[model samples]
Target: MFYRIHQFWQAIHPIITEDELAWVISLLPAPSLALFQGQPLPEQRHALDVAQDLWSSGIRDSHLLIAALLHDCGKTRYPLQLWERVAIVLLQKAPRKIWHTLSRSSLPLAASLQAAEAHPLWGAEMASHLGLDPRIVELIREHHTPHSQEGYLLYQADNRH
Candidate 1:
């Protein structure tokens, strides 16, 4: 609960340091950098924190590192307000079918929920379109389900952020 509050506050007030920008530039290609920068500031900060967490833990696998940085880029496709973000998390308690149905609806809130739930798929597709490595694409795609070791590591790092 404390963490949720902290995240909410951070989402409402995000900061991106010059050091973080340098770190991103050092790691990402120009295309990926653009994609990363296109995200809401909070999401960009979250991605940097997730990637930094993985790198600090000595997980030098490039794909995992990159995936950690870009895992939530899909949120760019359907930018959510802070309230919408909160509602999506709360609504996760709904049945899977209902969630899917809501996501498919034409309503704005439903699309926001879809963006929240399906970001991994959307991010993976974006990565693939950018010619990212298969491993990186897979890591982004399976961030929630985590089929492999790197995927789990990415998932863990994302949560830590």
Candidate 2:
């Protein structure tokens, strides 16, 4: 609980310095760069941190870096407020049927909840639209599942940051 609280606080005020933006731009293509910049400041910072962590650990796959930077781009469709994020985190532990029910209903946070649930697929679609590597799109889709070795690395790095 405390850890989540701390994470939420950090996310509420993500600080991305100019130097960090320059570093990020140097690593990404124009299309992918646009998507990365489209994300919330906190999410952008988080993605950059994840990519840097993977790089430091000797994972130099360009696709992985792209995946790390744009994995959460789908969240732009239905941006979650701080409370909505907290709700989604708690609701995620509930049964899938319950989650679906709430998400589909006309509840106040329903759209945000549904968006959170579907962001991975949405992100994958966006990646494809941008003509990103198929591997990068797959990573964005499967980051939460982590079945492959690369997926495992990304998942670990995402959790760490």
Candidate 3:
């Protein structure tokens, strides 16, 4: 996967610094485990479904497809189930209400959360450096926060599908 990403990275302009490579890589799904893993990651499946729906809607923008395919890529950086367990363990030492809030937070792993809002910037930089069209980077950056009618529609379809 890194090979593919490296190849793509080489084709684009230099936006992300060398120091940011590991940060960006940490956001991507484990390339090898992504396929034929014990179970398909829900986020990956959701992304694929979103991509298919977008494609079926006659949205020809490759940027949109790529964005939809990777919208939740950061989830891989965090393990929700593990955190849930940790939350449960911590709840034993805290109030029930506080434990409830923590459990319901649905927060990302520390590393993943650290990269949460940063994914867009990272993706934009990655796409720009990889020589992907600017629109593609924009789509990725805005996938979670659609700022227009078109973006809203895309988000709706992605969520609905």
Candidate 4:
């Protein structure tokens, strides 16, 4: 895993400074760099790696990479926790119209279209507010939708060994 990370690190440089890089490196577990691949980086790093893969494939579209990186960032709230909270609020307080709106969306792992519909919007909204590029946010929003042809290609490239 470390070898892959080293390979990736050697290939793509971040937008951050040396000091920031050093700080990020210091925070990573020594073995984690070597042992964990792909899905193993800290949430942000995982996103970065995904973006790097997209870029390396000659996809110069930076927004797609940014979308790849932040796809699951909302998971920071913890999936179970957020779902439960959302459910409680919907059941107890939300208006019928709002509940109907929520019922149409997707869940991350569910096979339903609802799950697929939910991810891009949620991810894009959070990422854009965090100062991610507008285009990237668009990619994130469209990621799971049928409209995301280019972004999906980048995503597929990123996950392949």
Candidate 5:
């Protein structure tokens, strides 16, 4: 629980250094680098950390690294404020019917909620449109699914920080 709180705080105020940006740019193509830059600072930091974790774990595949770096790019479409993120977390525990109703409501929260729920698919579509490798697109689309070994690693890394 405390870990989650720490994450929430971090998400609201992400800190990225110049060296980190340089390192990330070194790993991606020009267009993909633009997409990475489009992400919120927090998401950017998270992606960098995940990719670094994968590298430290001896996973050297460029596709996986790129996937980790851009997996949450979909969230850029509907950026959420800190409170909205909290609400989305709480909303996940609500019944499906309630969730659907809330998601469809006229409230501004609905957009962020919808985005949070659909980011994987949206991110995958974006990646595909950008002409990323099919494997990278697959990883983005199924980042939360946790069926394959790579997916599990991504999921674990995401949760860790």
Candidate 6:
């Protein structure tokens, strides 16, 4: 709950230093950087924190860093407003069947929720289309249900944000 509140604060006052932006730029290729830049400021801030968390934890794997930075790129596909994002979090507490059902709903905000729910897959596809490393794509795809140690670590960092 506290984390969600913090996320709300972040959403309102998303701040990233020029140096931090520079750091992210240095880490990504042109295509990947464009994808990162396409995210909302709040999402960009969250991604930076997630990537920084991985770096500070002694994980120097390039793919891990990249995946951490891009995990939410798919969120840009059907972007949500602040209220919608909050509602999505609340909606997530329900069963998977419920979420799946909601995703199928044609009601307003349902598409946004569905997009948020499926960002992992979409981000992975984006990464693959961008010709990024397979490791990075896999990490983004499985951050929600990790299939590798690195992916698990990425998921951990993302959850912290």
lDDT of 2 by residue, 1-161 (tens): 78667678778878888988887888788888989998888889789889989999998888888899888888887788878877887887799898889989998988888788789889999999999889999999988787688888888888777
Tens digit of per-residue lDDT, candidate 6, span 102-148: 77888787788777869899999999999999988999999889988
Better of 2 and 5 by lDDT: 5
Stronger candidate by lDDT (1 vs 3): 1
Shift of residue 31 alpha carbon in model 1, Å: 1.7
| Tens digit of per-residue lDDT, candidate 3, span 51-111 | 6677678976655666666654434444445344244334446775664554456664434
Q: 47-148, model 4: which lDDT tens digit per residue? A: 555655765678665445445655655443333333443453234355756545655646442322233336457666666666655766676666545366
Question: Can you give the TM-score per candidate against the true fold?
Answer: 0.88, 0.87, 0.47, 0.46, 0.86, 0.92
Ranking by lDDT: 6, 5, 2, 1, 3, 4
Which segments of candidate 2 are over 4 A away from where they belong?
Answer: 94-98
Over 4 Å off, model 4: 1-42, 80-117, 158-161
- Candidate 1: where is the Cα deviation over 4 Å? 93-108
RMSD of each: 2.0, 2.0, 13.7, 12.4, 2.1, 1.5
Sort the predicted structures by TM-score, highest score first.
6, 1, 2, 5, 3, 4
Score candidate 5 by TM-score against the native.
0.86
lDDT of 5 by residue, 90-148 (tens): 77778989889988999988888788889999999999999998989998888878667
Name the best candidate (by TM-score). 6
By lDDT, the best candidate is: 6
Name the regions of candidate 3 deviating beyond 4 angstroms.
Answer: 1-41, 74-114
Q: List the residue pairs that clash in candidate 5.
A: none
Q: How many times do residue backbones clash in model 1?
A: 0
Of candidate 1, the 10-residue stretch with the lowest lDDT total is: 85-94
